[model samples]
Target: MAGAAIKKKIGLFFGSFNPVHVGHMIIANYMATQTDLDQVWLVVSPQNPLKPKNSLARDYDRLHLVRLAIGENPNLRASDIEFSLPKPSYTIDTLTYLKEKYPDHQFVLIMGGDNLASLHRWKNYELLLRDHEIFVYRRPGYDIPQHFEEHPQVHFFEAPLMHISASYIRQAIQEGHSVQYLVTEPVFQYLESSALYKS
Candidate 1:
């Protein structure tokens, strides 16, 4: 008899994850449970073209933080695929590579309303919209743009939005404030142990 076929719908959540925080995990968990996605992969970007290079932590450190945040969640994973790819990683390229590598799995792009607003600025933005499905979670103040409000490939979810941000956490650490509930305990411990974000 033939082995069971490989068929899993994976949601790709791409971010720098300067230090993976609870907000990131909450959004991913919601997507995994509320949507048809079978799993969620937090694809850590080595360098986002739009972001400043100096604002990010080391690639491996960010990857490690993502892994630590995911912990034993069977349906959640951390990927360093972008690290091996070209610098200033682009979403379209990452999606294409993932599709080619995991032929049996359906990959959906997971992003926030803020990203949707700036989607047009992305490389091959039109191709990305036409080629893959995107799950956009609502952010605090950003609204879904009119152009993408009715897009066939775009789906919006009411995942809980947290005001917390990686930069905020880093600032707190640098200012000697408590970041207790902002990030996962393991990640917090790792950051402290490594003396990260401390200038």
Candidate 2:
């Protein structure tokens, strides 16, 4: 008898990745190296429904930054799947498209504890938890609630946490301050030459 095929596990780490900081790279690398996932796709979301759109950098610029940050790592990838999707891309819709587009791969939702806490507010939030593997990383001051226990598919990891935020980086750059180590060298150089975040 032939053994059943093992589906390739891909963790979808969705984010704005405003400048693709070192903190984002750290989490993505940790997840890919430590987890059962074969690859981790850093999905650069064009627009998040819950987040304010006014602050986001250009879609292609963010995507390019993510790609530059990832470089040639086989386990990590940059994705612009949401660019062609509708405005304010919904998680469920993106998952559905991926499922249909690539049937041989298993997709997992990579998120922070803060995102898990606000799951109730997402579009089709129940269906998202019901059908997909949700991998959550811990964040400072945000803890996953005990009341919502769905153990089997929802997994948690204590990946290294950093207090750095994209907003803080943006604010710093806007104020003519240095953001040298926050982002990768390529990203830093790119930011140095362009006025992407400067108001």
> Against the unseen true structure, what C-alpha lDDT does each candidate score?
0.90, 0.92
Give the per-residue lDDT digits (tens) of candidate 1, residues 127-165: 998888999998878877787888899999999878788
- Looking at model 1, the pairs that clash are none
Superposition-based RMSD of candidate 1 using all C-alpha atoms, in angstroms: 2.1
Model 2, range 54-132, lDDT digits (tens) per residue?
A: 8899999999999989888999999999898888899999999999999999999999989999999999998998899
Candidate 1, poorest ten consecutive residues by summed lDDT:
138-147
| Cα TM-score of candidate 2 | 0.96
RMSD, every candidate, angstroms: 2.1, 1.2
Candidate 2 has which clashing residue pairs, if any? none
How far does residue 85 in candidate 1 sit from its true spot (Å)?
Answer: 0.6
